[model samples]
Target: MRFELARLFLLERKQSDAFERRAADGSKLNREQWLREVFSQEIDFIHRKSERRFVPDQSRPKGEQRIVARIGRKTLSHENDPNDHLKEITREQWRACLVIIDPTSHDDGQKVAIETSSIVGSGFGNFESLITTINGHSPPEPFVIELHSITDQTTFWEYVDRHKGKITSIALEVVMPNMFGGSSSFEEDAKQLRDKEKARKIKETIENEDGLEPETERMRDAVSYATRGGGKVKAKAKGATPYDSTRDKKYIEADVDSENRDINQKTEAAIEAFNKDENEAVVEKEV
Candidate 1:
């Protein structure tokens, strides 16, 4: 069967080659026959060497497989560190390729397991150059391509006309690096700051209220005074102060532990005042 297939392929190639030779010799060409011969060769090649026929069992279940083509030294990392310097140095050294995924024959789901092909480029200019290269010199072997970002679909389709049949689908994901901290973290910090401010306002209201005993007033004043320097103390505690590490050790460090203790005490005292007022009202009603 293999021998027969090989012979059939050789015969088809000979026919196509003969048409080219005839046209080169200034002979009146049969256009339809020439087109048929060219198409026949392409179909024969696809049937024999296309990557669609060799997908593994494990990948079939997922309906798609993703393979990253490592074309540069810098790779996507878990830490999400900046790679601007590395990318700048290795800009010219980058290369790109295409990835093809062929669907399995046994899929029964509504979502048709699409065979996707992606052409990767290091950057926009490099990608355009890569597309031109593919147009001029189409590679035979299937490659795994990584698209760290999306390319213009129109531009891509223009160059990929040759291998359109092998590609059943195209899926491109644009992966942008998270340079700024995540939105969730920023929102959480804002919420915490708001809550702390609310707590500080409540403590101030309790300290300024009239009709308290002299000792109670003195206690409230002391708590308020203690918590007044909380901003600087909190900044130091969180290592946000520029002078935190550089300060001379001859002077004693400001006690952040005491600052936290004072804030907690003031918050508790405000809550206790509310509870005490409620208890007194209940006692008066009983009497």
Candidate 2:
């Protein structure tokens, strides 16, 4: 079955190649023959070779059909695999592929997985150029190309050439985001939370080491007071004195103390006056 399928793929590739050749030579080829050649079984051996080099190891369940294809670095997998008619696999296998790809990551490595629908929809070509570009620009070697589908290989190739020798083997796989089934994307979100936690810890460290808490509170209080006074605490006007030992810091402190003392005295006087008034009223009633 694999050999036959490989042949089918070869025949299809040949048709496309022949059409390209004809077009290059300015010859209008017959569409009927092109279509026939694309589906012919004569190139089974060649197709087998291509499949061995490109197709992934896939097995489908009974009564459920699927499709899988890898061109260069991009692996396109779908059911019937509607992403393309060239897929020849099972739905279960397809689902498994999604699981595998969904977990496969490019974290700190050359192996990166991206959403094919997003990339192609945004007008990017295939996996080759994308991988090559990442390999060239991103650090480390042996970058992997991962996508659900590739629309353009030529662009990928061009991008690859721009960054030569950096890229090694291309590992293509169809990575689909889990929708309703299992907890897949949950892992990524968890990772993000962990990162945020780490950041919060680092910030705490800085605050402790730099005495940020008290300093920040003081600054905030100063701003609040300035706001109450209806004036902005402008960056100490250009040439303002930074500090002065003889400056009356005592004046401000004394003013605050005096205000508190006056408030206390006023409260004591009011209490005494109220008591005296109540006593006089009681004495007059007795008389």
Candidate 3:
């Protein structure tokens, strides 16, 4: 049996409306600008850059790589039509999820998988339950779920009911493998060069600068002094108010002079004690 795949696109309804309005007005905003400025901020838009890839199939070799160019074309005139504006916005493919259901296994209950860009094969029972769960929780706005192989509405509803409430646990599966090489190497090399250049510039500035080292040394010394004994060195001026002694320059000078006098007295006393000890030792030796 030939298997058919269905594509579902998720869009932001409010953002799409605003975009349509802008398009109708012939505003200068482009697709990328609309996405970045308006769509990205909306809760349903799933803010991220859309990735383009080449899918490998029977027509293409497994190892073959193709670079999918970014969508750069301007919006077409037909896209501005009221009926077609929604389709144009959806074609941007910013956010989307996939639904896969097996129609032949209706007796055993159809198997269903809801897949998104980050998550895939999240099993769900029944289409109603899936819709309920998604909408009840955090629903992506303006979503379309397309089912392939099941052409009739009766078959679709039957499959949805068969798989209801029978969610299965399965490991994450990779739907597509990226085989392209060297696409990201340029960015990586450029980043490395920029980092190296930044480091070199910083090193050169440090080496060539004159006053930075001395200034840093002075700051270190000041910190050490403050931590050791500077906190106790309060200078007070004569005739200064007790509460405002710190703000008085004369009080500060007087306090400094007092501290210096105390240090000098201590030094003189130490010297005198040493001299007396030496004289006593000489007299004892002579005796």
Candidate 4:
């Protein structure tokens, strides 16, 4: 008897690669023939030497495919892998190749999983890139979640190249609430609390009864103060300095981009503040 098997990724997210497929008529490509035809490029993995067959004599619901793969194994090389001479093997595994093209951004990687690692230890193959390629969708550039300081120069350039044409302008801000460690966004709860408190304080400080300035101006003023550094300005609206020698550090070495671009007023203020010592250390960065 053949084994009935699958690893359900129907609840998987629709990230850059993990998406669904559709027919030319804007319908679900759920039929065996349709799926086989749609996943032609994926099934054609050079090393996998895989063949897919449609089993119609199964007692299953509609849109459920009885796609079987008789895949040939090959030794795959992985860098810095602890295992030596990696190899794979598989039987004629029967799985429901779930290609749900329900016509929405929300989709599961069921088909992607079925094509890749549905039955194998490391997965049969990665159909994500193939999907992107076939659909003319380019892979997203890596979104770096790193410390404002201690950035790798070589890696930074690589990222810059990836980011070109995607962004029109780039602005740097002094990262706030130095606290760290948490899930979801790796942003700490305490940091979030601190940010909330900071926002509250800014609202209180900026919205004086004398003449209420625009909320945007107040926020920008506070950001300029925090990023530019704290020094008692003659004016009140300009004195949203949250960070000072009493609060955090009096100052920090500002990273200045070498690119020839117009710096906004906030940036200009920050630069002016940082240049008090004239010879104040500045890092030349362009990204």
Expressed as tens digits, the lDDT of each residue in 152-194 for candidate 1 is 2222333234333332222111111111122343233433543
**RMSD of candidate 3 to the true fold?**
39.5
lDDT against the true structure, per candidate, is 0.23, 0.25, 0.24, 0.28
RMSD of 4: 24.1
Q: Highest TM-score among the candidates is held by which one?
A: 4
- Tens-place lDDT digits, model 3, residues 1-287: 01111211122233233224244456644422332222222122111232222111222223322111111111223344368555543233222222222222111112122321232121122222333333333333232122111111232223223443321211111111011111234223333543544211010111211112212343333222221111111211223211111121110001123435453343233333333433553575369
Local accuracy of candidate 2 as per-residue lDDT tens digits, 252-274: 00112344545334323333333
For model 2, the local distance difference test gives: 0.25
What would the TM-scores of all predictions be? Answer: 0.14, 0.13, 0.14, 0.19
Candidate 4: which pairs clash?
116-124, 117-123, 117-124
Off by over 4 Å in 4: 1-37, 40-42, 47-60, 63-121, 132-287
Better of 3 and 4 by TM-score: 4
Instruction: Sort by lDDT, best first.
Output: 4, 2, 3, 1
| lDDT score of residue 56 within candidate 4 | 23
Relative to the true structure, candidate 3 reaches a TM of 0.14
